[model samples]
Target: MNTAAYFAQIYREPDPFQYRQRWYEARKRALTLACLPRQRYRNAWELGCSNGVLSAALAERCDALLGTDLSAAALADAASSTAAFANVRFEQAHHPQDWPTGQFDLIVVSEVGYYLSAPDLSEMATRLRTSLADDGLLLACHWVHPFAEALSSAAEVHEALAGGLVEAFTYRDADLVMQGWGVSPTSVAACEGLR
Candidate 1:
């Protein structure tokens, strides 16, 4: 099945991925938010924003945020879930193809890269290299376990995205890998001139 159709069917349940009820998801959200080096971003984009759970949290820190999903159902849920946040909006996009134009200070790809084939993953990296702001941070989080839907493994996904970028931080667990990459990677303490 194509990614869009697959997601649309699953989203018929309106939270099929259980963003609100799943412990793993809750923990992942917390970890992703905490790992961000900056407290505020001028603009941010979240690819494959399942239900806007993360986007809602991100809205608190970004002047503007865009969340893209493959399915209208998911986007609708995302829009509703994030209705209170004026800075947040949901759009439907086909990934690497429908990617938004203009540079972003923050671009997050969470659990979405593995769905693309190796070539497409490479293309995504290329886009990230150019679409990202010079001082931008690209954060990626993915599941470590292999699944039937995965076109690439977590290692391949992260490796593909990290190309030509500097790794700022990384967190690994038995089930997931979360990391951030950027230009001129620096330490938080260093950003604060502690060193």
Candidate 2:
């Protein structure tokens, strides 16, 4: 199946990923947010923001936020899900091919990298160098356990990110791997002159 059809089927359910109702999803969002070195970003972009569960929370931390998804149905859900946030907007885009123009201070690829094949993910990683600002942060979170829909492993996805990217932070559990990267790196305390 193509990207749109696959996601179309997935979005048929009211909450296919159980992001709103699952402790795992909720806790994952908290962990993702907690891992950010900076409290606020000038501009943030999330790739494959299905249903916008995380996007809603990110909106609170970003001056301007863009959430991209492949399916119109999913974008509709995302739009409504983040409707209260005037700073947030939803756009339809296919990955790698339609990456938005301009740089972003915060770029998130959570749960979406493994869906791409290794070559595609590699291309994405390459594009990220140019897409991200010099002082920007790029984060990715993915399930460590293999699933049928996963075309690549979490390791392969993160490995792609490691090329030319400085690791800013890392978190690993048996179930998930989360990390943040940048060109020039510093700890949260360092960014705040606490160190």
The global C-alpha lDDT for each of the candidates, from Candidate 1 onward, is 0.91, 0.91
Give the poorly placed runs of model 1, Cα more than 4 Å off: none
TM-score of each: 0.97, 0.97
Clashing pairs in 2: none
Encode model 2's per-residue lDDT on 7-121: one tens digit a residue. Answer: 8888888879899999999999999999988999999999989999999999999999999988888789889999999999988988888889899999999888888877888
Tell me the tens digit of each residue's lDDT in model 1 across 39-122.
Answer: 899999999998889999999999999999898988888898889999998889987888788899999999899999888889
The superposed Cα distance between candidate 2 and the true structure at residue 1, in angstroms, equals: 4.3
Pairs that collide in candidate 1 are none
